[model samples]
Target: MHREISELIEIGRLLHSRGWLPASGGNLSVRLEDERVLITASGSHKGHLTREDFVVVNLKGEVLEGSKKPSAETELHLLVYRVFPEVKSVLHVHSINSTLISRMAQEDIRLEGYELLKAFEGIKTHETSISVPVLENSQDMEELSKRIEKKLREEKVYGFLLRSHGLYTWGKSIREAYIRLEAFEFLFECELRLMPLA
Candidate 1:
Protein backbone atom coordinates (compact mmCIF):
# COMPACT_ATOMS: atom_id res chain seq x y z
CA MET A 1 0.00 0.00 0.00
CA HIS A 2 2.81 2.36 0.85
CA ARG A 3 4.52 1.66 -2.43
CA GLU A 4 1.36 2.26 -4.42
CA ILE A 5 0.71 5.50 -2.57
CA SER A 6 4.24 6.66 -3.16
CA GLU A 7 4.10 5.92 -6.88
CA LEU A 8 0.81 7.77 -7.23
CA ILE A 9 2.27 10.79 -5.48
CA GLU A 10 5.16 10.74 -7.89
CA ILE A 11 2.74 10.76 -10.80
CA GLY A 12 0.87 13.60 -9.16
CA ARG A 13 4.06 15.60 -9.02
CA LEU A 14 4.70 14.90 -12.67
CA LEU A 15 1.21 16.05 -13.56
CA HIS A 16 1.71 19.19 -11.53
CA SER A 17 5.03 19.95 -13.19
CA ARG A 18 3.39 19.66 -16.58
CA GLY A 19 0.60 22.07 -15.57
CA TRP A 20 -2.01 19.32 -15.54
CA LEU A 21 -2.82 20.07 -11.91
CA PRO A 22 -2.18 23.48 -10.52
CA ALA A 23 -2.24 24.43 -6.85
CA SER A 24 -4.80 22.20 -5.13
CA GLY A 25 -6.86 21.64 -8.22
CA GLY A 26 -7.07 17.88 -8.70
CA ASN A 27 -7.51 14.55 -6.85
CA LEU A 28 -6.42 10.98 -7.54
CA SER A 29 -7.17 7.49 -6.23
CA VAL A 30 -6.32 3.84 -6.69
CA ARG A 31 -8.33 0.82 -5.66
CA LEU A 32 -6.16 -1.33 -3.47
CA GLU A 33 -8.39 -4.37 -3.35
CA ASP A 34 -12.08 -5.16 -3.41
CA GLU A 35 -12.77 -2.97 -0.41
CA ARG A 36 -9.87 -0.53 0.09
CA VAL A 37 -8.54 2.43 -1.90
CA LEU A 38 -5.75 4.97 -1.53
CA ILE A 39 -6.82 8.53 -2.29
CA THR A 40 -5.36 11.95 -1.97
CA ALA A 41 -6.96 13.93 0.78
CA SER A 42 -8.75 17.22 0.36
CA GLY A 43 -6.81 20.52 0.51
CA SER A 44 -3.43 18.96 -0.22
CA HIS A 45 -1.29 20.17 -3.12
CA LYS A 46 -1.11 17.15 -5.39
CA GLY A 47 2.46 17.89 -6.38
CA HIS A 48 3.64 18.00 -2.81
CA LEU A 49 1.70 14.95 -1.66
CA THR A 50 3.30 12.87 1.07
CA ARG A 51 2.48 9.46 2.46
CA GLU A 52 0.48 11.07 5.20
CA ASP A 53 -1.53 12.96 2.59
CA PHE A 54 -3.33 9.85 1.44
CA VAL A 55 -6.29 8.27 3.19
CA VAL A 56 -7.66 4.77 2.84
CA VAL A 57 -11.31 4.62 1.94
CA ASN A 58 -13.67 1.72 1.52
CA LEU A 59 -15.63 1.00 -1.65
CA LYS A 60 -18.62 2.61 0.02
CA GLY A 61 -16.59 5.88 0.26
CA GLU A 62 -16.07 5.65 4.02
CA VAL A 63 -12.66 6.45 5.34
CA LEU A 64 -10.95 3.42 6.75
CA GLU A 65 -7.75 5.04 7.99
CA GLY A 66 -5.47 8.08 7.88
CA SER A 67 -5.86 11.35 9.72
CA LYS A 68 -6.49 13.48 6.67
CA LYS A 69 -9.92 13.87 5.15
CA PRO A 70 -10.49 12.09 1.87
CA SER A 71 -11.08 14.30 -1.13
CA ALA A 72 -14.48 15.94 -1.44
CA GLU A 73 -14.65 14.33 -4.88
CA THR A 74 -14.20 10.84 -3.47
CA GLU A 75 -17.71 9.75 -4.35
CA LEU A 76 -16.91 10.13 -8.05
CA HIS A 77 -14.05 7.73 -7.68
CA LEU A 78 -16.28 5.31 -5.82
CA LEU A 79 -18.82 5.50 -8.61
CA VAL A 80 -16.21 4.64 -11.25
CA TYR A 81 -15.06 1.63 -9.30
CA ARG A 82 -18.60 0.45 -8.77
CA VAL A 83 -19.38 0.64 -12.45
CA PHE A 84 -16.10 -0.59 -13.89
CA PRO A 85 -14.80 -3.43 -11.77
CA GLU A 86 -11.76 -3.70 -14.03
CA VAL A 87 -10.74 -0.14 -13.21
CA LYS A 88 -8.11 0.13 -10.49
CA SER A 89 -7.07 3.76 -10.68
CA VAL A 90 -8.64 7.12 -11.50
CA LEU A 91 -6.97 10.43 -12.37
CA HIS A 92 -8.65 13.79 -12.30
CA VAL A 93 -6.95 16.94 -13.55
CA HIS A 94 -7.69 20.60 -14.19
CA SER A 95 -5.60 21.33 -17.25
CA ILE A 96 -6.51 24.33 -19.37
CA ASN A 97 -7.36 22.24 -22.40
CA SER A 98 -9.77 19.97 -20.55
CA THR A 99 -11.46 22.86 -18.78
CA LEU A 100 -11.71 24.93 -21.96
CA ILE A 101 -12.91 22.04 -24.08
CA SER A 102 -15.46 20.95 -21.50
CA ARG A 103 -16.80 24.47 -21.27
CA MET A 104 -16.97 24.79 -25.04
CA ALA A 105 -18.73 21.52 -25.79
CA GLN A 106 -22.48 21.62 -25.33
CA GLU A 107 -23.08 17.96 -24.64
CA ASP A 108 -20.06 15.87 -25.57
CA ILE A 109 -16.56 16.19 -26.98
CA ARG A 110 -15.90 13.91 -29.89
CA LEU A 111 -12.44 12.82 -30.99
CA GLU A 112 -12.33 11.25 -34.40
CA GLY A 113 -9.61 10.54 -36.96
CA TYR A 114 -6.79 11.57 -34.64
CA GLU A 115 -3.94 9.15 -34.55
CA LEU A 116 -3.54 9.80 -30.86
CA LEU A 117 -7.03 8.50 -30.32
CA LYS A 118 -5.43 5.09 -30.36
CA ALA A 119 -3.86 5.88 -27.03
CA PHE A 120 -7.01 4.83 -25.29
CA GLU A 121 -7.29 1.10 -24.68
CA GLY A 122 -9.36 -0.98 -27.16
CA ILE A 123 -8.66 1.41 -29.99
CA LYS A 124 -6.18 0.29 -32.59
CA THR A 125 -6.86 2.67 -35.45
CA HIS A 126 -7.06 6.39 -36.01
CA GLU A 127 -10.46 6.15 -37.71
CA THR A 128 -12.19 5.50 -34.43
CA SER A 129 -14.35 8.03 -32.66
CA ILE A 130 -14.80 8.48 -28.92
CA SER A 131 -17.47 10.63 -27.38
CA VAL A 132 -16.27 11.93 -24.05
CA PRO A 133 -19.25 12.98 -21.97
CA VAL A 134 -19.44 16.37 -20.34
CA LEU A 135 -21.76 17.01 -17.45
CA GLU A 136 -22.78 20.25 -15.85
CA ASN A 137 -20.52 21.22 -12.98
CA SER A 138 -21.81 20.78 -9.45
CA GLN A 139 -20.43 21.21 -5.98
CA ASP A 140 -22.50 18.40 -4.55
CA MET A 141 -20.45 15.22 -4.82
CA GLU A 142 -23.37 12.88 -4.19
CA GLU A 143 -25.50 14.50 -6.85
CA LEU A 144 -22.63 14.57 -9.32
CA SER A 145 -21.94 10.91 -8.67
CA LYS A 146 -25.56 9.95 -9.17
CA ARG A 147 -25.57 11.78 -12.46
CA ILE A 148 -22.45 9.95 -13.57
CA GLU A 149 -24.11 6.63 -12.66
CA LYS A 150 -27.10 7.49 -14.76
CA LYS A 151 -24.87 8.26 -17.73
CA LEU A 152 -23.12 4.93 -17.27
CA ARG A 153 -26.36 3.05 -17.84
CA GLU A 154 -26.80 4.44 -21.35
CA GLU A 155 -23.26 4.93 -22.60
CA LYS A 156 -19.78 3.47 -22.61
CA VAL A 157 -17.17 6.08 -21.82
CA TYR A 158 -13.44 6.16 -21.32
CA GLY A 159 -13.70 9.38 -19.37
CA PHE A 160 -15.91 12.39 -18.68
CA LEU A 161 -15.57 16.12 -18.12
CA LEU A 162 -17.16 18.38 -15.56
CA ARG A 163 -18.21 21.58 -17.32
CA SER A 164 -15.55 24.21 -16.80
CA HIS A 165 -14.06 21.90 -14.21
CA GLY A 166 -11.67 19.20 -15.37
CA LEU A 167 -11.06 15.76 -16.82
CA TYR A 168 -11.61 12.38 -15.16
CA THR A 169 -9.97 9.26 -16.60
CA TRP A 170 -9.64 5.77 -15.17
CA GLY A 171 -7.78 2.60 -16.02
CA LYS A 172 -6.66 -0.78 -14.77
CA SER A 173 -3.59 0.71 -13.13
CA ILE A 174 -2.13 4.03 -12.05
CA ARG A 175 0.11 4.00 -15.10
CA GLU A 176 -2.75 3.34 -17.47
CA ALA A 177 -4.84 6.04 -15.86
CA TYR A 178 -2.03 8.53 -16.31
CA ILE A 179 -1.68 7.51 -19.93
CA ARG A 180 -5.36 8.06 -20.52
CA LEU A 181 -5.18 11.46 -18.86
CA GLU A 182 -2.35 12.40 -21.16
CA ALA A 183 -4.27 11.14 -24.15
CA PHE A 184 -7.36 13.10 -23.17
CA GLU A 185 -5.35 16.25 -22.69
CA PHE A 186 -3.72 15.79 -26.07
CA LEU A 187 -7.04 15.29 -27.76
CA PHE A 188 -8.46 18.35 -26.05
CA GLU A 189 -5.56 20.48 -27.23
CA CYS A 190 -5.92 19.24 -30.78
CA GLU A 191 -9.59 20.05 -30.81
CA LEU A 192 -8.96 23.48 -29.39
CA ARG A 193 -6.39 24.26 -32.04
CA LEU A 194 -8.67 23.03 -34.78
CA MET A 195 -11.35 25.53 -33.88
CA PRO A 196 -12.06 28.02 -36.71
CA LEU A 197 -10.13 31.23 -36.37
CA ALA A 198 -12.27 34.10 -35.21
Candidate 2:
Protein backbone atom coordinates (compact mmCIF):
# COMPACT_ATOMS: atom_id res chain seq x y z
CA MET A 1 0.00 0.00 0.00
CA HIS A 2 2.82 2.40 0.83
CA ARG A 3 4.56 1.59 -2.40
CA GLU A 4 1.42 2.20 -4.41
CA ILE A 5 0.87 5.52 -2.69
CA SER A 6 4.43 6.60 -3.40
CA GLU A 7 4.13 5.61 -7.02
CA LEU A 8 0.87 7.52 -7.41
CA ILE A 9 2.38 10.62 -5.80
CA GLU A 10 5.36 10.51 -8.12
CA ILE A 11 3.09 9.94 -11.09
CA GLY A 12 1.01 12.92 -10.05
CA ARG A 13 4.09 15.13 -9.99
CA LEU A 14 5.17 13.89 -13.40
CA LEU A 15 1.73 14.40 -14.91
CA HIS A 16 1.49 17.84 -13.39
CA SER A 17 4.91 18.81 -14.67
CA ARG A 18 3.78 17.84 -18.15
CA GLY A 19 0.73 20.10 -17.66
CA TRP A 20 -1.64 17.19 -17.97
CA LEU A 21 -2.94 17.70 -14.44
CA PRO A 22 -3.39 21.36 -13.75
CA ALA A 23 -5.03 23.12 -10.83
CA SER A 24 -6.37 19.97 -9.25
CA GLY A 25 -7.96 18.78 -12.45
CA GLY A 26 -7.15 15.05 -12.33
CA ASN A 27 -7.63 11.98 -10.12
CA LEU A 28 -5.77 8.69 -9.74
CA SER A 29 -6.30 5.36 -8.00
CA VAL A 30 -4.89 1.90 -7.40
CA ARG A 31 -6.76 -1.26 -6.51
CA LEU A 32 -5.95 -3.20 -3.40
CA GLU A 33 -6.71 -6.62 -2.09
CA ASP A 34 -10.26 -7.49 -0.97
CA GLU A 35 -11.84 -5.14 -3.48
CA ARG A 36 -10.68 -1.97 -1.77
CA VAL A 37 -9.02 0.94 -3.57
CA LEU A 38 -6.75 3.85 -2.74
CA ILE A 39 -7.84 7.06 -4.41
CA THR A 40 -6.92 10.70 -4.31
CA ALA A 41 -8.97 12.96 -2.09
CA SER A 42 -11.34 15.58 -3.40
CA GLY A 43 -9.99 19.11 -4.01
CA SER A 44 -6.41 17.91 -3.64
CA HIS A 45 -3.81 18.95 -6.17
CA LYS A 46 -2.60 15.92 -8.05
CA GLY A 47 0.86 17.40 -8.44
CA HIS A 48 1.30 17.69 -4.72
CA LEU A 49 -0.41 14.57 -3.46
CA THR A 50 0.89 12.84 -0.37
CA ARG A 51 -0.10 9.75 1.54
CA GLU A 52 -2.43 11.90 3.59
CA ASP A 53 -4.24 12.96 0.45
CA PHE A 54 -5.41 9.45 -0.30
CA VAL A 55 -8.44 7.54 0.94
CA VAL A 56 -9.32 3.89 0.96
CA VAL A 57 -12.70 2.94 -0.41
CA ASN A 58 -14.58 -0.25 -1.13
CA LEU A 59 -15.55 -1.34 -4.63
CA LYS A 60 -18.97 0.15 -3.95
CA GLY A 61 -17.41 3.62 -3.36
CA GLU A 62 -17.87 3.54 0.38
CA VAL A 63 -15.07 5.02 2.44
CA LEU A 64 -13.05 2.47 4.32
CA GLU A 65 -10.30 4.63 5.75
CA GLY A 66 -8.97 8.19 5.90
CA SER A 67 -10.85 11.33 6.83
CA LYS A 68 -10.77 13.11 3.50
CA LYS A 69 -13.60 12.79 1.04
CA PRO A 70 -12.83 10.77 -2.02
CA SER A 71 -12.73 12.31 -5.47
CA ALA A 72 -16.09 13.17 -6.96
CA GLU A 73 -15.39 10.72 -9.74
CA THR A 74 -14.80 7.81 -7.39
CA GLU A 75 -17.84 6.11 -8.83
CA LEU A 76 -16.21 6.13 -12.24
CA HIS A 77 -13.15 4.44 -10.83
CA LEU A 78 -15.28 1.86 -9.10
CA LEU A 79 -17.15 1.21 -12.31
CA VAL A 80 -13.92 0.52 -14.14
CA TYR A 81 -12.75 -1.82 -11.42
CA ARG A 82 -15.99 -3.72 -11.58
CA VAL A 83 -15.94 -3.90 -15.37
CA PHE A 84 -12.28 -4.85 -15.65
CA PRO A 85 -11.25 -7.03 -12.79
CA GLU A 86 -7.66 -7.23 -13.97
CA VAL A 87 -7.19 -3.47 -13.93
CA LYS A 88 -5.10 -2.32 -10.96
CA SER A 89 -4.66 1.33 -11.73
CA VAL A 90 -6.89 4.04 -13.25
CA LEU A 91 -5.86 7.56 -14.21
CA HIS A 92 -7.80 10.63 -15.22
CA VAL A 93 -6.22 13.77 -16.62
CA HIS A 94 -7.44 17.04 -18.05
CA SER A 95 -5.11 18.12 -20.82
CA ILE A 96 -5.49 20.77 -23.47
CA ASN A 97 -5.16 18.33 -26.34
CA SER A 98 -7.61 15.82 -24.86
CA THR A 99 -10.13 18.54 -24.04
CA LEU A 100 -9.90 20.05 -27.50
CA ILE A 101 -10.00 16.81 -29.48
CA SER A 102 -12.89 15.43 -27.46
CA ARG A 103 -14.97 18.51 -28.26
CA MET A 104 -14.16 18.32 -31.98
CA ALA A 105 -15.14 14.66 -32.05
CA GLN A 106 -18.85 14.05 -32.43
CA GLU A 107 -18.78 10.50 -31.14
CA ASP A 108 -15.39 8.80 -31.08
CA ILE A 109 -11.87 9.77 -32.10
CA ARG A 110 -10.02 7.30 -34.28
CA LEU A 111 -6.27 6.73 -34.37
CA GLU A 112 -4.46 4.50 -36.82
CA GLY A 113 -1.05 3.93 -38.35
CA TYR A 114 0.64 5.79 -35.53
CA GLU A 115 3.68 4.11 -34.02
CA LEU A 116 2.52 5.29 -30.62
CA LEU A 117 -0.45 3.01 -30.93
CA LYS A 118 1.98 0.27 -29.96
CA ALA A 119 2.16 1.86 -26.53
CA PHE A 120 -1.24 0.40 -25.82
CA GLU A 121 -1.47 -3.19 -24.72
CA GLY A 122 -2.29 -5.96 -27.25
CA ILE A 123 -1.40 -3.80 -30.23
CA LYS A 124 1.57 -5.20 -32.10
CA THR A 125 1.58 -2.92 -35.14
CA HIS A 126 0.75 0.59 -36.18
CA GLU A 127 -1.40 -0.93 -38.91
CA THR A 128 -4.05 -1.39 -36.28
CA SER A 129 -6.68 1.22 -35.41
CA ILE A 130 -8.23 2.38 -32.14
CA SER A 131 -11.41 4.31 -31.55
CA VAL A 132 -11.60 6.26 -28.31
CA PRO A 133 -15.16 6.90 -27.29
CA VAL A 134 -16.15 10.36 -26.19
CA LEU A 135 -18.88 10.71 -23.59
CA GLU A 136 -20.92 13.72 -22.65
CA ASN A 137 -19.77 15.08 -19.30
CA SER A 138 -22.19 15.39 -16.44
CA GLN A 139 -21.97 16.33 -12.78
CA ASP A 140 -24.16 13.33 -11.99
CA MET A 141 -21.55 10.62 -11.68
CA GLU A 142 -24.15 7.84 -11.58
CA GLU A 143 -25.39 8.83 -15.01
CA LEU A 144 -21.87 9.24 -16.31
CA SER A 145 -20.77 5.89 -14.93
CA LYS A 146 -23.79 4.16 -16.42
CA ARG A 147 -23.11 5.71 -19.80
CA ILE A 148 -19.46 4.70 -19.68
CA GLU A 149 -20.33 1.20 -18.54
CA LYS A 150 -22.74 0.79 -21.45
CA LYS A 151 -20.15 1.98 -23.97
CA LEU A 152 -17.39 -0.15 -22.49
CA ARG A 153 -19.54 -3.23 -22.84
CA GLU A 154 -19.82 -2.49 -26.57
CA GLU A 155 -16.18 -1.44 -27.23
CA LYS A 156 -13.00 -2.79 -25.76
CA VAL A 157 -10.90 0.35 -25.64
CA TYR A 158 -7.75 1.16 -23.70
CA GLY A 159 -8.98 4.62 -22.88
CA PHE A 160 -11.75 7.18 -23.38
CA LEU A 161 -12.44 10.92 -23.32
CA LEU A 162 -15.14 13.05 -21.73
CA ARG A 163 -16.53 15.79 -23.93
CA SER A 164 -14.72 19.02 -23.05
CA HIS A 165 -13.57 17.31 -19.85
CA GLY A 166 -10.60 14.98 -19.99
CA LEU A 167 -9.33 11.43 -20.49
CA TYR A 168 -9.51 8.18 -18.52
CA THR A 169 -7.26 5.17 -18.93
CA TRP A 170 -6.46 2.07 -16.91
CA GLY A 171 -3.92 -0.72 -16.80
CA LYS A 172 -2.91 -3.82 -14.95
CA SER A 173 -0.40 -1.68 -13.12
CA ILE A 174 0.22 1.97 -12.37
CA ARG A 175 3.19 2.09 -14.72
CA GLU A 176 1.17 0.72 -17.59
CA ALA A 177 -1.62 3.18 -16.94
CA TYR A 178 0.87 6.06 -16.98
CA ILE A 179 2.34 4.84 -20.23
CA ARG A 180 -1.10 4.59 -21.85
CA LEU A 181 -1.99 8.07 -20.63
CA GLU A 182 1.19 9.48 -22.10
CA ALA A 183 0.58 7.72 -25.38
CA PHE A 184 -2.98 8.99 -25.54
CA GLU A 185 -1.81 12.53 -24.90
CA PHE A 186 0.76 12.27 -27.66
CA LEU A 187 -1.80 10.89 -30.08
CA PHE A 188 -4.28 13.63 -29.25
CA GLU A 189 -1.62 16.27 -29.84
CA CYS A 190 -0.64 14.77 -33.16
CA GLU A 191 -4.25 14.61 -34.31
CA LEU A 192 -4.90 18.18 -33.26
CA ARG A 193 -1.78 19.44 -35.06
CA LEU A 194 -2.83 17.74 -38.29
CA MET A 195 -6.41 18.93 -38.19
CA PRO A 196 -5.66 22.32 -39.76
CA LEU A 197 -3.92 20.61 -42.68
CA ALA A 198 -6.92 18.34 -43.20
For all predicted structures, in order, the TM-scores are: 0.97, 0.98
Who wins the TM-score comparison? 2
Model 1 poorest 10 in a row by lDDT: 148-157
What TM-score would candidate 2 get against the native? Answer: 0.98
Number of clashes recorded per candidate: 0, 0
lDDT agreement with native, every candidate: 0.90, 0.94
Per residue, candidate 1 scores C-alpha lDDT tens digits across 78-146 of: 899989999999999999999999878877888899998888888999988998989998998888888
Model 1 TM-score, 2 decimals: 0.97
